[model samples]
Target: MAMIVFYEKPGCMNNTRQKQLLAQSGHDVVALDIRAQGWSPETLRPFFHGVPVAEWFNRAAPRIKSGAVVPEAMAAAEALAEMCLDPLLIRRPLMESGGRRMAGFDEEAVNAWIGLTPVSEPISETCPRSDGMCSVPGRGN
Candidate 1:
């Protein structure tokens, strides 16, 4: 198993589930809050390597849902600029392992890299709360 640094938004249920799956896959996860990290375009660019700007964003983010931004219309620099202006615009689970990094969790890619397989099927149901549904920090309750 490999150790992975997983950058995520705290209080996001999906992020929690993603972490759980990673652990179940036998990965050693080190989860960190994306907001707390001091990130710049220089550091952030690698996560999106070989990935399109649109793929780097959190499609569920309110701004994106409200159609305020369209990922395809923006250039890579523009996309990075916008995300630097609001980190929340970036996708969840910026992952790093084996000196390589990527944005979001591509199941196939992860499995190939770490030899993790699906034991239980994924939860198909979406989170049944408002977009702002958040929990108290440090309390998994």
Candidate 2:
């Protein structure tokens, strides 16, 4: 079993589900509060490797949802700066195992990296809510 360092926003449903999946798959999950962990560009940048700058953001974040922060319009450095200042802007469940790290829970990618139990229902990436709002109380970062 792998030891996974999972950085997430507290009280986030998606993050809770993701951790459950990892644990059920026999991995040891160490959950951290993403908002409380002070992050810098160098440390946070690796989670988003190969992804476009726009995709690095948490679309559910209030700033993004409210049109206060435009992910698509920012450059890589600028985006990183913004996210470092407000971690809620960073995508959910930034995961690390062994020496590798990744952002977001892409089921296929995660399965390949650390093996997830096969499921008919999709369990990663997509928000479970349909109203464009999360079920958890208090707006997601």
lDDT of model 2 at position 32: 98
Backbone clash pairs for candidate 1 read: none
Q: How accurate is candidate 1 locally (lDDT)?
A: 0.77
Q: Write the per-residue lDDT of candidate 1 for residues 17-133, one digit (tens) a residue.
A: 878888987889999988778778898999998887778887766677788989889998888888888777888778899998978776777788775758566532133345633
List where candidate 1 sits over 4 angstroms from the true fold. Answer: 123-141
- Weakest ten-residue segment in model 1 by summed lDDT: 123-132
Which candidate number would show the highest lDDT if scored against the true structure? 2
**Weakest 10 consecutive residues, lDDT, candidate 2?**
126-135
Task: State each model's CA lDDT, in order.
Answer: 0.77, 0.86
Candidate 2: segments with Cα more than 4 A from true spot: 124-141
Superposed on all Cα atoms, the candidates' RMSDs to the truth, in angstroms, are: 3.0, 2.5
